[model samples]
Target: MTIRMIGRHIREGLKNMWRNGWMSFASVSAVAITLLILGAAMVVALNAEQLSTYVTGELEINVYLNQQVTDAQGQQVAREIDQLSGVKSVQYISKEEGFKRLKKMVGTQYASFMESVNSGNTLPVQLVVKAANPRETTKVAAEILSVPSVHNIQDGENVLGKLFSFLNAVRDVGLAFVIALIITAMFLISNTIRLAIFSRRREIEIMKLVGATNWFIRWPFVWEGILIGVLGAAIPFAIIAYGYQFLYHYSGGAFVALSFPLMKAGLVAHKIGGILFGIGIIIGLWGGIMSVRRFLRI
Candidate 1:
């Protein structure tokens, strides 16, 4: 369509909103609530994944060697672990080193008693094992268990597994909630546009009876919905933008230190802003078309 035609559609759309002030206000309110929920959900989903990843990165396995395994046997076992597909690194700690570490951990009060307990009998030579992927740690440990000298593994990586499941559930549930709310927002917007169409029913009928195509009649209401959606999105964008920045600077970015960081404010605003506007535009366009559908049939 020509620029002039598009301009006219925009003008007529804005004029309809001005004439139907209360309904327009209600539509904007509905969309604003929907987008606000959307913004909150986005933040949660992003952070849940971040937390999961942080935990995964920190996860590691401690592989204990058989006390009878010779130094040569321990060296071979370390090589085997290093060769494992998912192994990130292998660090060998001899019985002497382990006993020293034990004393350091148990502290000076217990140091005298720990010295009498022979290092070879009390402490097993072991490998500190890290996996390339956190999720594969269990598998890596199991494979290591099959080797000749690997005696045991500790912690079983239970925490990392539970964390992955919980975070995934959070993301999935949030997605479903956002989708349902968006559909609800569309209906709210469409209903408001329907009222606007009802007020102009006679004009629509006359346009239909004449040579005006469906596209021509649909344009104004479509623009009306688009305008409503855009306006609805604006409030939430401001709230999310400033609120995220405050949390980033004032609250130290994330709930956890080091491994976990809330996405930066500039990045959050950029991403969330685009998403909010896109949802707004789609809801408006669809609501407008749906509202105008019955009027076009006349």
Candidate 2:
């Protein structure tokens, strides 16, 4: 289309909104409310996903070397574990350092007494192993156990298994819930826009009868739909961005003294905002085209 035609279509689209004032308000309101609900759900779901990641990241496997293994053998074992597919990193800690850590953890009151009786340090030299992902931890731990220098693995196998299952279940539920909401938003937004266009059936029919092509009949309404969607999303996007930032600060980065920390508001708010705007535009465009297709029979 020429620039003049594009400008005309835009001019007509804006004019249509005023011509159908009540219908336009209804369409805009419906889009705003639906996107608000969807945006709120997204916030909750994203935070849950972040929490799941944080908790799982804290889980690591501690590999204790056998007493017969030398310092050189321990280093070799660490290197071997680092070479494993699922392994993220491996750090070797000497028995002397481990003993110091024990002292520090046990507190100064008991440190002197423990030192007085400490003729020998029985703490084994160990490797601290981290998995690339929480789901891969079991495989990584199993591979670590295969090393001949490893005497034992302390990964809380049973607890870790249960934790993984629970986290996975929560993630699946969150994902399904978000998807359902999105589908509902699309349906409701389209239906609302459909109502707005249905009122203009006579205008559409006259245009068609006057030799206007389907594209020409549709462009004005499409622009109007896009505008409605963009306007509706503006408030919710702003609210979510500022609200999440306030919540993040009020909670001091984590949730009420909990170990799980939220994703940085500055980092994720703009990203979420962009996602919200994109989704709004897409849903608006879809509602526009679909309503035009069904109601105007174009």
Candidate 3:
């Protein structure tokens, strides 16, 4: 509690670590390895979720108009669809524009084939609808289908459904893996701390015989555990920060082919640093408490 008591605990903790050099190294190594795995997993999970979101946000609904629909009727339909709930924006593409776009897509080799069609630009006028919320694309598409000039709709419902399902599965699996790793890490750390304290059992008994309070005897080992945790987490934190920065820069801002963008390196590092530090402290304290309690049998 007092400064002097804190200083004594820290000094004793350092002495204990030195006294059992091999065991101390093992404990620190265990902590570092566990935290490193956790940090890497966090990075992957965060980026995967972001990529899923980016792809979802690009989804759109295409409403094709009937061949006989007049320009005025098409404009009216666009106005009505834009007013619908969950609709973000609606742009009308005339039949002529659609034909030009098709021609551009087919390239020079197929230009003659498109020109041979005798139906005189049979491509239907279309209203491209963007949803304010990606999850509501189906709902917005349904509303657009009810509009007067809308002959049909292509909302990619099946593809979006599969995408959402895959993302959810990834999230669930990542969560489960993290939980398993945490449990395993705690178990290993607790056992290592117990072994470290077991070697000092005689000293603890001697302190008790000399009328030292249990709190006084326990503080040093607790500090030792905390130190191990902090030391283990430190290297992983540095590695993650530097590695992520390199990766972000190397990938150039966005992976255009995948339609995914990495979060700013500084922001990701800051958040992950806080998380690793907090977890380190908690695991250290927990291992200490468990080890001390088992040894003291109190």
Candidate 4:
């Protein structure tokens, strides 16, 4: 299309919006609401995964040695653990060290009780294995238990397994919700455009009578719809970004640490912004096309 024709179509679309003020507002509002919900869902999904990852990273496999094992025998077991696949690091917690840690964790509640129990009898020297992936922890735990002196393994496999499963389920549900919102938004916008074009039947009829090409007539309406969608999305995008910025700066620390699949605020915004913008444009164009198709049929 020529620049002049394109300009004319844009002016007409804007004029249509003003002439059909309530309908235009409704269309933009619907698009805005849909995009906003989808955006929020995506942000939540990202953070959920991050939080899960953080927890996984923090996971430790505790290999408790038989209290009968000598210190030299325990050290040999620790060396074997360090060489195992997926093991990030190995820290040896002597029975004495374990007792001290127990004291800190229990605080004052068990301080007096701890004094009566012999440290060697109460706690066994342990090889704490940190894994690169939480799933690998089970394998590491099994391997540690195979060692002669390592009589028991106490990795929190049951808990991590349940947590990972829950995270996956939540992510799937969030995705479904976002997809549904997108579809609903698309339909709502399409109907609004249909109404907008329906109100301008005479103008389209006149153009059709003049033998104007299909592209010539259709392009403008599509562009107009796309522009409206873009405009609508821009407002909420800014609002969401600003809100995230505020939360990240102030109320975000606790949330950040706990995120399942965590990300910094800046990185999350950068990744999601382009996607939201593209979604806005696509939905707008779709609405415009649907609206114009009916007009062309007549």
Q: Give the TM-score of each candidate.
A: 0.78, 0.63, 0.84, 0.86
Q: Taking the tens digit of each residue's C-alpha lDDT, what string does model 3 give over 1-298? A: 8999999998988887887788778777777777887888778767767766776788889899998886777888888888888899998898778888888988899877988872677777888999999888888888888877689999987976787788678767866776676666666667666776777888888988999998998898788888878987898899998998998898896765774788788887887898888888788778878888887664
Better of 2 and 3 by lDDT: 3
* Global fold similarity of model 3 (TM-score): 0.84
Error of 3 at 248 (Å): 1.1
**Which regions of candidate 4 fall more than 4 Å away from where they truly are?**
70-72, 83-88, 118-121, 132-135, 252-262
* Residue 3 alpha-carbon offset, candidate 2, angstroms: 3.6
Off by over 4 Å in 2: 11-60, 65-96, 106-125, 129-150, 155-168, 201-214, 244-274
Q: lDDT by residue for model 2 over 23-133, one digit each (tens)?
A: 667666766766677677677667767866676878789999997777787788788888889888888898778888888889988977879756677777888898888
Question: What is the C-alpha lDDT profile of model 4 across 97-128, one tens digit per residue?
Answer: 78788889888887888777743355678888
Cα lDDT of all candidates, in order? 0.83, 0.77, 0.81, 0.77
* Candidate 1 C-alpha error for residue 150, in Å: 3.2
Which scores greater on lDDT, model 1 or model 4? 1
RMSD values, in order shown: 4.0, 5.4, 2.9, 2.8
List the candidate 1 regions with Cα displacement exceeding 4 Å: 66-80, 83-86, 93-126, 132-135, 202-216, 257-259, 296-298
On TM-score, the candidate that comes out on top is 4
